[model samples]
Target: MKEDYLDIKTPEYVAIQFQIAGLGSRAAAFIIDQALLMLVNILSIVVLYFVMVGMEPLPVFLSHSSFPVAIVIIGLFIINWGYFFFFEFFSGGRTLGKKIVGIRVIQENGHSITLLASFIRNLIRLIDSLPTAYFLGIIMIFFHPKHKRLGDLVAGTIVVHERKAKKKKLTPIEKEINLRGLSQNNLLLDEWTLKSFTSKDWKLVSTYANRFTQLPLKERNQLTKQIADILLPKTGLDSAGKTERELEDMILIIYLILKDEWEFEL
Candidate 1:
């Protein structure tokens, strides 16, 4: 069964869901990558220190070899750069840890990004990580509405939650409620008829409801009756059959018209 009453309209709702998924996956991957890189750097430094100390016993060897140090630095740069390229280019925006955690990065409009887009985004991280004391990436995350980093912006991508499976069940009586007749076009809702609503659309309806209530009681009742008349034919219900409670029920029915299940009842 589907919970058709739930609606997500604002960007904040989307952003929050994205963040929850990212923290569990993308963020974990990043932390592991950084830890591994730091370990490699430390190990390189230790090996260089021992090599230099051993060379002190031989002046000729010490005087001739800054090349090894330069080579090690170059190797480190190549290793780090290649690591980023390998993951971003071939793995569909996931590193080993991200894959384990179940999240994939995709374009803002929801498409697979190209290798060049990924490269440009990560390469520019050098500038974003600047000032020798602070990370500009964190600042960018805080300032951007979508919490995107420079890489995300350049790649035109956003991290999103992988869709999870939903459990559904139905009752025997609910199976007999035919819902083929329900569709958005068939439901007629007007300002006054939705006055007592308390769902997501309630805010929208409440504005008009308040306005209608400001009029004289007789005028308000006449307006409500007029709205009911307009809705009756569209809903395929008789005038005598419909009641005030059906007004709110109609809103619920209209909202769920597109859902897979036909179990909704008043």
Candidate 2:
């Protein structure tokens, strides 16, 4: 079966692919979020009532004044908005629902979404829910090529699944890397240098190092040079005038360094 993929040539000039999440998964995720929100709202009102007017009958507390009602209204606004914002920005683009559904948001260009982008997308969610229960948003997602809603289009983001799970068995290239005794100790990379690399960098390096050995000579050289062009400069190492083997070795050294910091998850 043919699967739809969201392929982005990142600003870093590396090609990456993610599976595009479709309407069914996205709708389920939203339903989960709304259910959680409702539960929270009810709990909050109950807790506030108990604390503010203990043991008082619910009818009496409500009849006393508008203060409790007003507070509840304000609380609703904060909880609804803050829930999505905090999670999306800090949790790498997954709300609890999205996490459960195994999908996350990212920029159109294949980067982790920025804080501003997160804010914009969620803010526009109000419009996406327009006229009813996401009537407009569902239409946009169904018809659009990328399944993007107005929020996603405006914020330049899309939801996608994580990459295929990494294999447990060591491939031939991995075995060769182990045999060659290539590691961070062989080459120098400082703590600060390592900190500069993001998870995306690790993905690029790992993909290149693992696959280069499997290709034909010409293809291997081309792939090596393309990857080298992107990653080596970050390590204060230049690939210019270096042979393909040397480049491959440098990348392995980087992989060893990055391995200490990153677990291959997505």
Candidate 3:
């Protein structure tokens, strides 16, 4: 059957499917966010007006002729810019609208949204708003295969339906290892290394393990190397001459060995 899903490789080398949100859903979410932002703008304007009225008797205040207008403009700018930036960056890619709509933003590679990417996407919002009310963005989303707008394309992100659990299928090797039990082999992990990982870290590792096999060979190797580089030092494992496939296998072994701990933390 045909589906509208993005395939993310897990550390177990299996592909997990995440449904891509459609244009209608995205548009509805954007409208909700815009309405909320409008409410904030109105409240801010009223507060500022009251404050200015209270300061009317101040001496020489009128001498700074353009100050009030500039302040109002700057405040609007902050509300417009800060709202999305803070929400997307700090809320793990879900603005209030997105959360309500059961969708979220993520990198093309299925990683969490980064601060820089969020900033870039929001910064290009001006372009998306061209010809009034995100006309250009609407056109782009309608035509794009993934329903991504200009900002998403430029930032290398996509909006997808939020998933509660993305489980990874166990490989034959992993199954064999589990049969032998993790206690039999340390897999180079110890108490210190395990302690270094927080719930978030564990989740990331688990995701990588679950999604590893589904990723392209090059991307799988790259992510494996990147993750290994971060973990090797902590685990005191040497990668002096390990092949890419070997390094990838090492990470999978680590995840398998700590499956119980990860499951508990999750």
Candidate 4:
């Protein structure tokens, strides 16, 4: 049987998988945190009740006063919110839930999410949790291809698994040399370059291949040049030729590079 492997070349596709992993982790963390918080709150309330009872015989009217109960509720809310905010916003986007689940929230562009974004996302959780049981958020997850909740979509953020370290058979020197070569090419595409492809580009390439073929040679060449320029900053393409086909081949090479599966035919 052939060995199966996860492909990492398609950033969009990989992002989806990361979303799933992250959601699972976050859910688990939430349950644990809630459980712990509940236990602590219960214990504290019990202790407080005993202390209050020991101080004096409670009047019936005072016993029904909502002030103490309100304080406890507010305190619990603050503790839970504070813990979530600190970890999700400050600790590299991972809370105890995220850390155990091996996922973190990040910006849509694959950058670290800002404090503002984090705050907005968390604040919006109230809406996402509406109508009891977070049903809206759950529905969004099922319906959205990226499994984004209202907060994630509104804040232009995503949850992703941190890339795991893979053991490579290649020696350090060889790896360095390969990296250098990849960095030297002016026409080669890189991971970021390929991932930057717009939906229009994908549509044209996939659904309108015939129309693309009908474009003028100069136009096609120009398009290739633009793509090459975007990728050139990060890749080292052999500058021996400048043909359109050569440009396409270079893009393919970059796809392979991003996948870390390049094999030279020659």
Candidate 5:
């Protein structure tokens, strides 16, 4: 069967694929979020009503002051903006709605979403909501090939269906790869060691992994040399015995180790 997927070539040469979430799923997620927001608003209104009633006996100056008004406005703003920002940032890009719908947001390059991007996207969400009921957002999602609304386009993010595997067991090849990545020589390499490589570095490794077989020998050799040169010393991998021709193999192993350590999420 044919399926639509977005293939992202990371700088590491790995070609990652994601199935994009369409208009209907996105709309459903948005509806759920809105319903949640309405619930919060109702609760806030009830609390504020009590507060106002309690303040009725206070000095007229305090009762008529703008402090209560200002507090109410701030509360609304936080409820609207904080809800999205905190959820997406802390939940690995899955808001309550998106999680329920089995979808999530990620960077255009397929990296996990960052807090800043989450803030920017949700900030622009105000514009997307203009002219009543997300009419503009709906139009953009309908026309854009990837189903991105204005906020997503502005923030360099896309919504994708979470890929869930039914089986928990690893295949023979998978077990072998995992064992290879966890060999005695790679024991020192942990999350801290992985942090030495930047996001760009990982992307390059990813690109190489996914595109390795397809790359021309000459280009592949060049990439292998370039990436190996940067990673060799930082990773503390000894290359004294290896030749230039073997550097590609070393880099490929490094990529595998890093991939196993940092399996991309969200």
Candidate 6:
């Protein structure tokens, strides 16, 4: 099949693209999920059987009056449906199967799947799995342009491969800091003194340091001085008699140090 893409725009009109997942990948993911569900269901049935009947013979289990078979049916129903609903609802639209397959369910508008949407989709999965397997669902997916089964079409969701995260290019401040070597030794920040700066302080510095490049020249200087004034005292440094450029360098320096402590590379 030709590679199909979904193009969407955010509220800000930033366009994004996603590749639609096709039958092969979706089927693989479903098989994985079904395998896991089968395991859980078997375990649950065994536990319930023992709990209801004890170690007693089949007569206890077979005794219609003593056996609550409806409970077993209900438990199995919940597990079969709940597995998909709970995982899709809470796991950002990816079950373990979908996550491993690198695909996720999302709304047609490209947002995360909503709770109601997840419920409706998985509820319709009963119909999708008609005639022993997902025969109808498979046919629908193979024929649908977006590869949506009835569940997805009904729920206004699509399965799409996750977009690989683009590496963030260095901000202007980062480039300048790299050029000037904004390291701990050069900045002379005492280890103990730096640790005193809290997450809130990091937010103050990071906001300005990372976003300074995007502001207009005059506004950038004003915000830099404002952020510098708030942060300097925490680091046992003052912005006294410093140029806005120098103040910006100091903020970027703090940013570099604190980011190391707080942020992990992804």
Q: TM-scores across all candidates?
A: 0.46, 0.62, 0.61, 0.52, 0.61, 0.65
Q: lDDT value for candidate 5?
A: 0.81
Residue-pair clashes, model 1: 0
lDDT of every model, 2 decimals = 0.56, 0.86, 0.81, 0.63, 0.81, 0.87
Candidate 2 TM-score versus the reference: 0.62
The residue pairs in collision within model 4 are 29-97, 184-236, 185-236, 185-237
Report the number of the highest-TM-score candidate. 6
After superposition, the stretches of candidate 4 with alpha carbons farther than 4 Å from their true spots are 1-25, 54-64, 170-266
**Cα RMSD for candidate 3?**
15.3
lDDT of 5 by residue, 87-131 (tens): 988998888999999999999999889988999999998888889
Model 2, 121-195: lDDT tens digits are 999999999999999999999888888999999999998987768779987877888888787788887888888
By TM-score, is 1 or 6 better? 6
Ranking by TM-score: 6, 2, 5, 3, 4, 1
Candidate 6 per-residue C-alpha lDDT over 149-232 given as tens digits, one digit per residue, 9 for 90 to 100: 999999999999999998999868777678877765547677788788888887777777677778899999988888888888
> Which segments of model 5 are wrong by more than 4 Å?
1-3, 59-62, 65-67, 166-266
Task: Name the regions of candidate 1 deviating beyond 4 angstroms.
Answer: 1-28, 42-64, 100-102, 132-134, 167-266
lDDT tens readout by residue for model 4, 40-133: 7888789878877786767665576696788678887777677767787888888776777677887776667888888888888888888887
Where is model 3 poorest over a 10-residue stretch in terms of lDDT?
A: 176-185
lDDT (0-100) at residue 86 of candidate 4? Answer: 74
Of 2 and 5, the candidate ahead on lDDT is: 2
Question: Candidate 4 at residue 76, lDDT?
Answer: 76
Expressed as tens digits, the lDDT of each residue in 1-266 for candidate 1 is: 21111123354445212332332344566677777777978897888778778775656545656866786889888767667667766888766556666766666655565777777777876766676422676666556656567877877766555556666664321231223343445565564544433343333333324454256756755555555554444545565656554543453354344232222421
